[model samples]
Target: MTAADDSPVHQGRRAALVRQLRARGIANEAVLTALGLVPRHLFFDSGLLPQAYQDKAFPIGAGQTISQPYTVAYQSALLAPQPGDRVLEIGTGSGYQACVLVALGAEVHTIELEPSLSARAGRLLARLGASATLYVGDGSVGLPTVAPFSGILVTAGARRVPPALLRQLAVGGRLVVPVGPADGIQRMLRIERESATAFRQETFADFRFVPLRGAEAVAPAPSQSGAETIRSAES
Candidate 1:
């Protein structure tokens, strides 16, 4: 199926997104600029591009759903990304949020567990001229070597905030993750690293997401004693 023209459609959708964002208490202009600039449809199924602006989630292949537009905007606003900040994003599902983050001129490095989805998103993001370091790995690990980022965002739900990710944050940096107990609902959490050893947690209202699965997820990956999987599976 042919996708809608990227410009006109996205412009209209962006206006609507901005309105929703304000209503939801997203007050950052930089975040709004990024949300308005990125073409959300580029990260969606071609056939559904026409409805890309609606405040709802759409199906992405591999059984994952691109987050609803409001959630993306909300999370970005909560993280309060700055133009020069280096942001590490976990779960690049459709690369929509990554695109939005980087479009505001953030230096973005994203990790995705599903190789197939990651590869496809890498190509599409490049086509949009979004500069992001895309890595196919476990989200639970968060991106190491590139630690001490200015901000971090995770797009999946986890039973508990993985402590490893918290350690990677630069002092005063923020890590936004979905944390909740299994069989219970999830809530958006903004964790600020007060120092190398402490974090301040700010919780938000209810939200739903795919469970976080990777080496550090609630369930340990299959391995013999002292052996590691090295990589996560495709979703």
Candidate 2:
């Protein structure tokens, strides 16, 4: 059905998905609630609706997949956006993540590299009454015109954190992204801007994502480091 068709069946499936997410270690109530409220089925093509609430990723065209529900909730919990937090999302994808961020009461600004995907997501978001500013461009470099975001979420895999994204974060802001070889599993990293020149990094479980494209596809050479602290969940 359409976004407006949030029937009992859809609601029930959505609730079941939420429970599954909780059981899988998504403990943040706010993130769970947001996921519960967002009609994931609406983000899928009518023919793909059957698999919408399966907690699995599905192709969303243009070589990208609507991230599995667990991954979305996991990253949202890591970002921990407060109400009214200004958040930037790279790769808008199905705009499902942006809707989750909106449901969390954040001011959302999302950019996508694929114009068609961005257009489709914008229409869906508008239909659902989610207020998120959508842009079409190279998301790896981020939306600098609206820099200093309170939180940033990247939905793709990269070899290293883009310096531009880091520079766009407001002090205390968090950038949640996946970093690793393009052909291998990636570690989910939550990098928090502690100050003008210092950042704190936390590494989480491994996840495989479509390689981030555009300027981020080419790994950058290692350079002089900045002051940073790292903690790995696997440590």
Candidate 3:
């Protein structure tokens, strides 16, 4: 989101975003608060800022698009983050989703494979006075040292759930991601931990997302160091 500078017009738009989110069936106070606080326009291309609160997705850069408001809200509703809950986010494109999680009171630990995007988002979050542990690393592997997160969210689409992420999920924790082919069809999926070794996965409505890319998608090219960010068609 962008700096408001106390413009009445911009403040009006923020209120409208909240109403739009509510119309889309997001009733959670924390979710609404997050959506309202996040400057969606600041997270998108300057040319696309006018439509930021229109409840649609907009291109950010690197061929990746900040997800639509509803998709963000849908997954967030499922995340159910509580105060101080450590949440892991995959694909921290513009830090919008992570901002939302923070609004919902989660302590965010986000991984982004693209260095430039990671750096930009880190700066943006810091500028907003929010602090999150930003890791310029593969989201697929997750942050092993920060395992046992209370909640996990994959902003990108994955061919299948990454096993490493599953291993990091705390027992009874939940994860929400998009699962399907990137080019064809994708379904929003939510996974709930049944035990350390088991999880129950449920598919939500169809959606689209940037593909999840990392060393797991292909062997690590020696020249690459945390440079993978593929818009994988989730399978």
Q: Give lDDT per model, in order.
A: 0.81, 0.92, 0.80
TM-scores for all candidates: the values are 0.87, 0.94, 0.87
Best by TM-score: 2
The sequence of per-residue lDDT tens digits that candidate 1 reaches over residues 1-235 is 1345466656777888888887878788888878887777777776896778888988787777899977888889888887889999989999999999987778999999889999999998888888899999988888778887999998988887776687788988988988776556799988887765556777787888888888788764334454311121121
Give candidate 3's TM-score: 0.87
> RMSD in angstroms, all models?
7.0, 2.2, 6.6
- Higher TM-score: candidate 2 or 3? 2
Among all windows of 10 consecutive residues in model 1, the one with the lowest summed lDDT is 226-235
As for model 2, its CA RMSD to the true structure in angstroms is 2.2
Q: Which has the greatest lDDT?
A: 2
What is the lDDT for 31 in model 2? 99
> Sorted by TM-score, highest first, which candidate order results?
2, 1, 3
Q: Candidate 2, which ten residues in sequence have the lowest lDDT sum?
A: 226-235
Model 3 global lDDT (CA atoms, 0 to 1): 0.80
Q: Candidate 3 residues 10-51, lDDT tens each?
A: 668889878987887888888888887776666766677678
Residue pairs of candidate 1 with colliding backbone atoms: none
